[model samples]
Target: MIDQLLKMADGPLQDLLSQSGMSGTESTASAIEDTFGSLLKNKAQSGDLSAIKEMFSGSDTSPQSPVIQNLAGDLSSGLMDRLGISSEQAMSLAKTALPLLMNFFNQRINEAPQANEDIMNSVVKALQGGPGSGGADILGSLLGGGKGGGMDLGGLMNMGKGLFK
Candidate 1:
Protein backbone atom coordinates (compact mmCIF):
# COMPACT_ATOMS: atom_id res chain seq x y z
CA MET A 1 0.00 0.00 0.00
CA ILE A 2 2.84 2.37 0.79
CA ASP A 3 4.39 1.29 -2.47
CA GLN A 4 1.24 2.17 -4.38
CA LEU A 5 1.02 5.50 -2.54
CA LEU A 6 4.63 6.25 -3.33
CA LYS A 7 4.04 5.47 -6.99
CA MET A 8 1.00 7.72 -7.09
CA ALA A 9 2.93 10.42 -5.24
CA ASP A 10 6.13 10.13 -7.23
CA GLY A 11 5.75 13.34 -9.17
CA PRO A 12 4.56 15.43 -6.28
CA LEU A 13 7.11 14.00 -3.85
CA GLN A 14 9.87 14.67 -6.36
CA ASP A 15 8.73 18.22 -6.70
CA LEU A 16 8.62 18.68 -2.94
CA LEU A 17 12.06 17.18 -2.46
CA SER A 18 13.56 19.36 -5.19
CA GLN A 19 12.05 22.48 -3.74
CA SER A 20 13.57 21.53 -0.40
CA GLY A 21 16.98 21.20 -2.09
CA MET A 22 16.93 17.46 -1.52
CA SER A 23 17.35 14.59 -3.96
CA GLY A 24 16.89 10.81 -3.96
CA THR A 25 13.25 9.97 -4.38
CA GLU A 26 13.66 6.59 -2.79
CA SER A 27 14.97 8.05 0.46
CA THR A 28 12.30 10.69 0.50
CA ALA A 29 9.64 8.09 -0.08
CA SER A 30 11.03 5.98 2.71
CA ALA A 31 11.08 8.94 5.04
CA ILE A 32 7.49 9.80 4.27
CA GLU A 33 6.38 6.24 4.80
CA ASP A 34 8.39 5.95 7.98
CA THR A 35 7.04 9.16 9.43
CA PHE A 36 3.48 8.23 8.53
CA GLY A 37 3.77 4.77 9.98
CA SER A 38 5.37 6.07 13.14
CA LEU A 39 2.64 8.61 13.68
CA LEU A 40 -0.06 5.97 13.41
CA LYS A 41 1.81 3.52 15.59
CA ASN A 42 2.51 6.04 18.27
CA LYS A 43 -1.09 7.12 18.37
CA ALA A 44 -2.33 3.58 18.48
CA GLN A 45 0.10 2.62 21.18
CA SER A 46 -1.02 5.54 23.28
CA GLY A 47 -4.62 4.47 22.89
CA ASP A 48 -5.39 7.44 20.72
CA LEU A 49 -6.97 5.95 17.66
CA SER A 50 -8.94 9.07 16.88
CA ALA A 51 -6.52 10.15 14.20
CA ILE A 52 -6.60 6.80 12.46
CA LYS A 53 -10.34 6.66 12.81
CA GLU A 54 -10.71 10.14 11.38
CA MET A 55 -8.53 9.41 8.41
CA PHE A 56 -10.22 6.16 7.49
CA SER A 57 -13.72 6.98 8.59
CA GLY A 58 -14.63 8.61 5.28
CA SER A 59 -16.66 11.12 7.24
CA ASP A 60 -14.36 14.06 6.57
CA THR A 61 -11.76 14.86 3.94
CA SER A 62 -10.94 18.43 4.76
CA PRO A 63 -7.18 18.91 5.00
CA GLN A 64 -7.76 21.68 7.52
CA SER A 65 -9.28 19.37 10.07
CA PRO A 66 -7.38 19.47 13.34
CA VAL A 67 -6.60 15.77 13.13
CA ILE A 68 -4.98 16.02 9.70
CA GLN A 69 -3.39 19.35 10.53
CA ASN A 70 -1.83 17.89 13.63
CA LEU A 71 -0.57 14.93 11.66
CA ALA A 72 0.87 17.21 8.97
CA GLY A 73 2.57 19.31 11.62
CA ASP A 74 4.16 16.25 13.18
CA LEU A 75 5.19 14.88 9.82
CA SER A 76 6.59 18.23 8.72
CA SER A 77 8.62 18.66 11.86
CA GLY A 78 9.96 15.14 11.55
CA LEU A 79 10.89 15.69 7.92
CA MET A 80 12.57 18.97 8.65
CA ASP A 81 14.66 17.48 11.42
CA ARG A 82 15.47 14.32 9.48
CA LEU A 83 16.24 15.92 6.11
CA GLY A 84 17.78 19.19 7.31
CA ILE A 85 15.21 21.22 5.45
CA SER A 86 13.53 24.48 6.23
CA SER A 87 10.24 24.45 8.09
CA GLU A 88 8.51 25.89 5.05
CA GLN A 89 9.81 23.17 2.81
CA ALA A 90 8.91 20.48 5.30
CA MET A 91 5.43 21.90 5.76
CA SER A 92 4.91 22.09 2.04
CA LEU A 93 5.69 18.42 1.71
CA ALA A 94 3.44 17.51 4.63
CA LYS A 95 0.52 19.63 3.48
CA THR A 96 0.66 18.02 0.10
CA ALA A 97 1.15 14.45 1.17
CA LEU A 98 -1.30 14.34 4.05
CA PRO A 99 -4.27 15.22 1.89
CA LEU A 100 -3.31 12.71 -0.72
CA LEU A 101 -2.99 10.00 1.90
CA MET A 102 -6.33 10.88 3.43
CA ASN A 103 -7.91 10.97 0.02
CA PHE A 104 -6.58 7.51 -0.65
CA PHE A 105 -8.19 6.23 2.54
CA ASN A 106 -11.42 8.02 1.77
CA GLN A 107 -11.46 6.47 -1.67
CA ARG A 108 -10.97 3.03 -0.23
CA ILE A 109 -13.77 3.56 2.26
CA ASN A 110 -16.11 4.68 -0.49
CA GLU A 111 -15.11 1.86 -2.79
CA ALA A 112 -15.72 -0.88 -0.26
CA PRO A 113 -18.54 -1.05 2.23
CA GLN A 114 -16.61 -3.33 4.54
CA ALA A 115 -13.41 -1.27 4.34
CA ASN A 116 -14.20 1.08 7.21
CA GLU A 117 -15.32 -1.76 9.47
CA ASP A 118 -12.34 -3.88 8.61
CA ILE A 119 -9.96 -0.99 9.05
CA MET A 120 -11.45 -0.13 12.41
CA ASN A 121 -11.24 -3.73 13.54
CA SER A 122 -7.69 -4.05 12.37
CA VAL A 123 -6.71 -0.81 14.04
CA VAL A 124 -8.22 -2.00 17.31
CA LYS A 125 -6.21 -5.17 17.04
CA ALA A 126 -3.07 -3.21 16.29
CA LEU A 127 -3.64 -1.03 19.34
CA GLN A 128 -3.79 -4.15 21.40
CA GLY A 129 -0.32 -4.92 20.09
CA GLY A 130 -1.55 -7.78 18.01
CA PRO A 131 0.97 -9.49 15.74
CA GLY A 132 3.68 -7.07 14.53
CA SER A 133 2.57 -4.54 17.13
CA GLY A 134 1.86 -1.61 14.85
CA GLY A 135 -0.14 -0.27 11.92
CA ALA A 136 1.62 -2.84 9.74
CA ASP A 137 -0.79 -5.50 10.90
CA ILE A 138 -3.75 -3.26 10.24
CA LEU A 139 -2.53 -2.43 6.75
CA GLY A 140 -1.43 -5.98 6.08
CA SER A 141 -4.71 -7.44 7.18
CA LEU A 142 -6.61 -4.81 5.27
CA LEU A 143 -4.62 -5.37 2.10
CA GLY A 144 -3.86 -9.09 2.42
CA GLY A 145 -6.66 -10.70 4.36
CA GLY A 146 -8.35 -13.52 2.47
CA LYS A 147 -11.91 -13.83 1.34
CA GLY A 148 -14.55 -14.71 3.87
CA GLY A 149 -17.50 -12.70 5.19
CA GLY A 150 -16.07 -9.33 4.20
CA MET A 151 -14.40 -7.71 1.21
CA ASP A 152 -11.37 -9.62 -0.04
CA LEU A 153 -7.90 -8.14 0.19
CA GLY A 154 -7.52 -8.10 -3.57
CA GLY A 155 -10.58 -5.92 -3.89
CA LEU A 156 -9.06 -3.46 -1.45
CA MET A 157 -5.85 -3.41 -3.45
CA ASN A 158 -7.86 -2.76 -6.57
CA MET A 159 -9.51 0.19 -4.86
CA GLY A 160 -6.08 1.60 -4.04
CA LYS A 161 -4.91 0.95 -7.60
CA GLY A 162 -7.78 3.01 -8.89
CA LEU A 163 -6.39 6.05 -7.08
CA PHE A 164 -3.22 6.14 -9.17
CA LYS A 165 -5.04 5.99 -12.45
Candidate 2:
Protein backbone atom coordinates (compact mmCIF):
# COMPACT_ATOMS: atom_id res chain seq x y z
CA MET A 1 0.00 0.00 0.00
CA ILE A 2 2.67 2.44 1.05
CA ASP A 3 4.78 1.30 -1.86
CA GLN A 4 2.11 2.45 -4.29
CA LEU A 5 1.56 5.55 -2.20
CA LEU A 6 5.26 6.37 -2.30
CA LYS A 7 5.05 6.52 -6.04
CA MET A 8 1.97 8.71 -5.88
CA ALA A 9 3.32 11.22 -3.37
CA ASP A 10 4.66 13.49 -6.15
CA GLY A 11 8.09 13.66 -4.54
CA PRO A 12 6.83 15.68 -1.62
CA LEU A 13 8.96 13.67 0.80
CA GLN A 14 12.05 14.15 -1.29
CA ASP A 15 11.29 17.81 -1.88
CA LEU A 16 10.59 18.45 1.77
CA LEU A 17 13.69 16.60 2.88
CA SER A 18 15.80 18.62 0.48
CA GLN A 19 14.25 21.84 1.65
CA SER A 20 15.13 20.96 5.22
CA GLY A 21 18.77 20.55 4.16
CA MET A 22 18.72 17.16 5.79
CA SER A 23 21.36 14.70 4.61
CA GLY A 24 21.29 10.89 4.52
CA THR A 25 17.55 11.08 4.72
CA GLU A 26 16.86 8.40 2.19
CA SER A 27 15.03 6.30 4.77
CA THR A 28 12.84 9.14 5.92
CA ALA A 29 10.33 8.42 3.23
CA SER A 30 10.25 4.78 4.16
CA ALA A 31 9.77 5.71 7.79
CA ILE A 32 6.83 7.92 6.97
CA GLU A 33 5.32 5.15 4.87
CA ASP A 34 5.70 2.70 7.72
CA THR A 35 4.18 5.19 10.08
CA PHE A 36 1.16 5.51 7.81
CA GLY A 37 0.58 1.77 7.77
CA SER A 38 1.06 1.57 11.49
CA LEU A 39 -1.44 4.30 12.13
CA LEU A 40 -4.12 2.60 10.03
CA LYS A 41 -3.40 -0.72 11.67
CA ASN A 42 -3.58 0.78 15.11
CA LYS A 43 -6.80 2.53 14.24
CA ALA A 44 -8.33 -0.71 13.04
CA GLN A 45 -7.05 -2.61 16.04
CA SER A 46 -8.59 -0.02 18.30
CA GLY A 47 -11.96 -0.46 16.61
CA ASP A 48 -12.11 2.79 14.71
CA LEU A 49 -13.41 1.20 11.54
CA SER A 50 -15.86 4.00 10.89
CA ALA A 51 -13.04 6.40 10.18
CA ILE A 52 -11.17 3.85 8.13
CA LYS A 53 -14.31 2.92 6.30
CA GLU A 54 -15.12 6.52 5.58
CA MET A 55 -11.58 7.06 4.34
CA PHE A 56 -11.46 4.19 1.84
CA SER A 57 -15.02 4.80 0.76
CA GLY A 58 -13.90 8.21 -0.44
CA SER A 59 -16.63 9.86 1.58
CA ASP A 60 -14.25 11.89 3.74
CA THR A 61 -10.82 13.04 2.76
CA SER A 62 -11.12 16.60 3.91
CA PRO A 63 -8.10 18.00 5.71
CA GLN A 64 -10.43 18.67 8.60
CA SER A 65 -11.32 14.99 8.85
CA PRO A 66 -10.21 13.34 12.06
CA VAL A 67 -8.56 10.55 10.12
CA ILE A 68 -6.60 12.95 7.95
CA GLN A 69 -5.66 15.14 10.88
CA ASN A 70 -4.48 12.15 12.89
CA LEU A 71 -2.54 10.87 9.92
CA ALA A 72 -0.89 14.27 9.59
CA GLY A 73 -0.03 14.35 13.28
CA ASP A 74 1.39 10.85 13.19
CA LEU A 75 3.42 11.58 10.07
CA SER A 76 4.67 14.79 11.62
CA SER A 77 5.81 12.91 14.70
CA GLY A 78 7.57 10.32 12.57
CA LEU A 79 9.43 13.08 10.76
CA MET A 80 10.41 14.73 13.99
CA ASP A 81 11.53 11.47 15.55
CA ARG A 82 13.30 10.06 12.54
CA LEU A 83 14.79 13.17 10.94
CA GLY A 84 15.15 15.57 13.85
CA ILE A 85 12.89 18.00 12.03
CA SER A 86 11.32 20.60 14.24
CA SER A 87 7.73 20.14 15.31
CA GLU A 88 6.84 23.13 13.19
CA GLN A 89 8.73 21.86 10.14
CA ALA A 90 7.24 18.41 10.49
CA MET A 91 3.77 19.90 10.83
CA SER A 92 4.34 22.16 7.86
CA LEU A 93 5.39 19.22 5.76
CA ALA A 94 2.45 17.10 6.86
CA LYS A 95 -0.07 19.90 6.33
CA THR A 96 1.35 20.59 2.90
CA ALA A 97 1.62 17.02 1.63
CA LEU A 98 -1.11 14.89 3.27
CA PRO A 99 -4.04 16.42 1.38
CA LEU A 100 -2.53 15.74 -2.02
CA LEU A 101 -1.80 12.14 -1.13
CA MET A 102 -5.19 11.52 0.48
CA ASN A 103 -7.04 13.36 -2.29
CA PHE A 104 -5.36 11.13 -4.84
CA PHE A 105 -6.77 8.06 -3.12
CA ASN A 106 -10.13 9.75 -2.70
CA GLN A 107 -10.32 10.45 -6.41
CA ARG A 108 -9.22 6.95 -7.31
CA ILE A 109 -11.81 5.40 -5.05
CA ASN A 110 -14.55 7.61 -6.43
CA GLU A 111 -13.79 7.02 -10.09
CA ALA A 112 -15.96 5.32 -12.72
CA PRO A 113 -17.26 1.83 -12.03
CA GLN A 114 -14.78 0.15 -14.35
CA ALA A 115 -11.94 1.95 -12.61
CA ASN A 116 -13.26 1.16 -9.16
CA GLU A 117 -12.15 -2.45 -9.14
CA ASP A 118 -8.43 -1.91 -8.89
CA ILE A 119 -8.67 0.82 -6.30
CA MET A 120 -11.25 -1.11 -4.29
CA ASN A 121 -9.05 -4.16 -4.45
CA SER A 122 -6.26 -2.07 -3.06
CA VAL A 123 -8.50 -0.79 -0.29
CA VAL A 124 -9.66 -4.30 0.57
CA LYS A 125 -6.11 -5.51 0.67
CA ALA A 126 -5.07 -2.65 2.88
CA LEU A 127 -7.85 -3.30 5.36
CA GLN A 128 -7.37 -7.05 5.21
CA GLY A 129 -3.91 -6.98 6.72
CA GLY A 130 -2.51 -7.60 3.25
CA PRO A 131 -0.29 -4.51 3.27
CA GLY A 132 0.42 -4.21 6.98
CA SER A 133 -2.66 -4.43 9.20
CA GLY A 134 -6.47 -4.87 9.39
CA GLY A 135 -8.12 -8.21 8.76
CA ALA A 136 -11.24 -10.28 8.11
CA ASP A 137 -11.86 -10.66 11.80
CA ILE A 138 -11.79 -6.93 12.23
CA LEU A 139 -14.10 -6.37 9.32
CA GLY A 140 -16.29 -9.23 10.37
CA SER A 141 -16.55 -7.66 13.75
CA LEU A 142 -17.74 -4.53 12.11
CA LEU A 143 -20.20 -6.57 10.05
CA GLY A 144 -22.03 -8.17 13.02
CA GLY A 145 -19.58 -10.86 14.06
CA GLY A 146 -18.52 -8.75 17.02
CA LYS A 147 -19.85 -5.25 17.47
CA GLY A 148 -23.25 -6.28 16.05
CA GLY A 149 -23.93 -4.46 12.71
CA GLY A 150 -22.46 -2.56 9.82
CA MET A 151 -22.42 -2.99 6.08
CA ASP A 152 -20.87 -6.07 4.56
CA LEU A 153 -17.63 -5.95 2.59
CA GLY A 154 -19.46 -5.82 -0.70
CA GLY A 155 -21.45 -2.88 0.54
CA LEU A 156 -18.21 -1.24 1.54
CA MET A 157 -16.94 -1.65 -2.00
CA ASN A 158 -20.07 -0.17 -3.52
CA MET A 159 -20.34 2.55 -0.90
CA GLY A 160 -18.71 5.28 -2.91
CA LYS A 161 -20.71 4.58 -6.02
CA GLY A 162 -23.40 7.13 -5.23
CA LEU A 163 -21.46 9.46 -2.97
CA PHE A 164 -20.24 11.62 -5.82
CA LYS A 165 -23.53 11.58 -7.70
Task: Report lDDT (CA) for all predictions.
Answer: 0.64, 0.56
Question: Tens digits of per-residue lDDT for model 1 on 42-91?
Answer: 87777887677876686756878787778888899888888788999888
Instruction: Tell me the TM-score of model 1.
Output: 0.65
- Candidate 2 wrongly placed segments (more than 4 Å): 2-6, 10-28, 112-165
In order, what is each prediction's RMSD in angstroms?
Answer: 5.4, 8.6
lDDT of 2 by residue, 32-151 (tens): 656665666676656565445655566547777776677788789877887688999888767755665566556666664534444444445445444322233333343333342244
Identify the candidate with maximal TM-score.
1
Best by lDDT: 1
Compared with the true structure, the alpha-carbon lDDT of candidate 1 equals: 0.64
